[model samples]
Target: MTLKLSLSLSISLVLVVLFSIDTARAGYMEVTLLGTGTPKPSIDRFGPSTLIEANGRYFIFDSGRGVSIRLQQAGVALSKIENIFLTHLHSDHISGLSDLWLTSWIWQRQHPLQLTGPVGTLALSQHLELAHQADFSYRTKNTSLNSNFFPILAKEIVSEGIIYQHNGIKITAFLVNHYPVEPAYGYRIDSGEQSIVISGDTSFSENLIKHAKGADLLIHEVAAANSELLAGNPRLQKVISYHTTPKQAGKIFTATEPKAAVFNHVLLFGISERAVLEATRESFNGDVRMGHDLMKIGVGNELIFY
Candidate 1:
């Protein structure tokens, strides 16, 4: 081969390699908080839901109230989502599944939705399908809906470990202490370049601390401070027992040492935002912020908030 031709080919190969590196760098791992509230409904906050976008793929952490609406607001198409990971079967956490399922199918989403979570997830999916049997039957007969697409793929998480792996994306589910719920979970998503941890409604969990250590971002559930008003309330105590306070969450953040920590599923019934922030800052000196509905955060070399 001529030296001139060899030189030209080498230059072209170098350009291609540079272009690939630039493209990968331009891609971002974005996390959008679709709902940041709990069971107690609020006008501003919906329910506990989050969307993680990595490598052009989207994964939903939980399908909470108004998730479909918030997802649209975030510029995400319902058809693009194929799987949903539920921490537990709490009414508030899975409330928006019906809306997401029905709306996507109506809009001609051809892929079967995959729901992954603890043991009872399959049962939950079956029950929802039964409840919508009449609608499914009518839609199948009257419309061009494919009956094959009606069945949802339910993956029941039987043990603690890596539950999902596709391409370079790996999702690990670890047991959390949302006791009486048996097998509640917190998930860690590692997409080669970025890592995110979502604490799905748990108390101070050592397992979470182990998994979340040095994550790019950690989104943990936090409850309102136990103040004088809630001091004697048995119901309030029960709620607090099953969840983590901002102070406790802060300590966990300190231990885990993430690049940034977000307090989500905020149960601020009476306490002010100032109180929550102060409590979290008392222990954790890292970059910490409270989560709000529709808040967008990107994890890359540095944390970006949108």
Candidate 2:
């Protein structure tokens, strides 16, 4: 064999290796919506929930109705999901938590599920342990596995700080304005150079704007005034008093111009664009997108869709 031929072959091999490494690299991140409705359940909408996939792991934000099914539809296995972050303790945002806990427990992973939430998390965690006692006991006794079925590790946070981190991903939680609810939070996820922010459940709070500044993507709640305007009860009006008007959310977007903004908590501008229009009327000129149930919007270093 000629030395020149060997050198040429080595160069070819180096090129192949470099290409493979580049392909393997890339901050793979995917965001999938599980539920899009609020407490006022609608036939066309589910509750507030979202799934964040990054760096080969799944981190869920809130677990509303049909979340498990949605996750399955998104091709995410229950066993792969180990971390859950809750914005608040609202039933609409966390109603499906027990189901997630039970399903993961059924998989017998031999470890406590990671749950991060607000200050009252300890009490709620205790209640869940007690509430789901019969089911956990039944599974443990009836199954052949020898693992604790109801082991849940709770991490409660009462203030703003870094909540969770894995590999190169960082999830930082911050306080948001949602009065009467006492403590509410919004989370910013930093993976590599890309960042995404998820506003749990809050009114029109500029704190969210600040938290989500310069992020690649922002997913927050956009509430419509139609419900309050058309409802026949004062109770409905009270709900609006605490949540964001689409216009108010627009104003927030004005303050902070992110790469892209998505609204998903409630049925804000689904049927009527009145709320969205009101928000658009404000100062935000960027992309203010309306989020739907199970909708997937890719915004980051590289496009990821599943």
Candidate 3:
């Protein structure tokens, strides 16, 4: 073959390789655990939060404590955040909402913040607005801040169904039993090619198992069973009663049979990780991972964790 013809062919091959790489990187869902601990404060874990990136958009599930800090650590830009979903109105799960809203606004968030959750979400948004009235008023009056930037479009979920869908990303909310705190929910996000389920905070719910069925990833909450810490405190015991035990979570994992299962919002009070892992292993024959803040999963043909 002529040398010129050989050079042209080499260039064509290089272009093809580059295109293949780009295509492989696109159209996939990525999940990151922003926080993996419960309401109890811990130095290592923040609160219950996860970040989902798919279809060139970013969705956050539960803006728990330190969510903004974790998001910045994960190199997620405020501009890329399309919406925020709440599992429940539990203080631990929504504590970081204000931080995310106020801080992201300061950083020049030009679009309205989309907030979605159960029935009281609209009231919650109104409460937040009332809480920050002074700041919002002063900022807009003194600075060049556009009032539109502070606008929040809150969607109160009234029933179990598809709550949001856009750009090939669809999210569904279903009721979970975290009662006394009525109308709690679990969420399922389908990004066309792959799906993920987040068990916000619940006891054993058949509804959750139904939604999580055959998902690529399932991030569920787990509490230690009959811990010494719970024996004395009735309040703590009540909390534990409303949450799923590690073994129950394992059974849920088996029933759903996701490609991988992650235990998030872990409530470990005097219970070792070994105890929880062993309990889960009894029922779940598939991969089971304990979630930690900043942990990331890239969903492609296989689950890639970082």
**CA RMSD of each candidate after superposition:** 2.8, 3.6, 3.1
TM-score of 3: 0.90
Please report how far candidate 3 places residue 63 from its true position, in Å.
Answer: 0.9
Q: How do the candidates rank by lDDT, highest first?
A: 1, 3, 2
Q: What are the lDDT figures for the candidates, one per model?
A: 0.89, 0.78, 0.88
- Candidate 1, residue 233: the lDDT equals 85
Q: Is candidate 1 or candidate 2 better by TM-score?
A: 1
- lDDT tens digits, residue span 184-207, model 3: 999998875578999999999999
Task: Give the worst 10-residue stretch by lDDT in candidate 2.
Answer: 266-275
Residue clash pairs of candidate 3: none
Q: Encode model 2's per-residue lDDT on 161-247: one tens digit a residue.
A: 898877988999999878888788889998877788998878888778788887878887866655545477576567666777776
lDDT of 1: 0.89
lDDT of 1 by residue, 1-306 (tens): 699999999999999999877655554589999999998888688888999988788899999999999998988999888889999999999999999988988878879999999999999999999999999999998999878778889999999999989867899999999987879999999886678999999999999999999899999998875478688788888888889988898999999999999888988758897889898999989999988899999888778998
TM-score for each model: 0.93, 0.86, 0.90
Lowest-sum lDDT 10-residue window in model 1: 19-28
Candidate of highest TM-score:
1
Candidate 1 residues lying further than 4 Å off, grouped into runs, are 1-27
User: Which candidate ranks first by lDDT, i.e. highest?
Assistant: 1
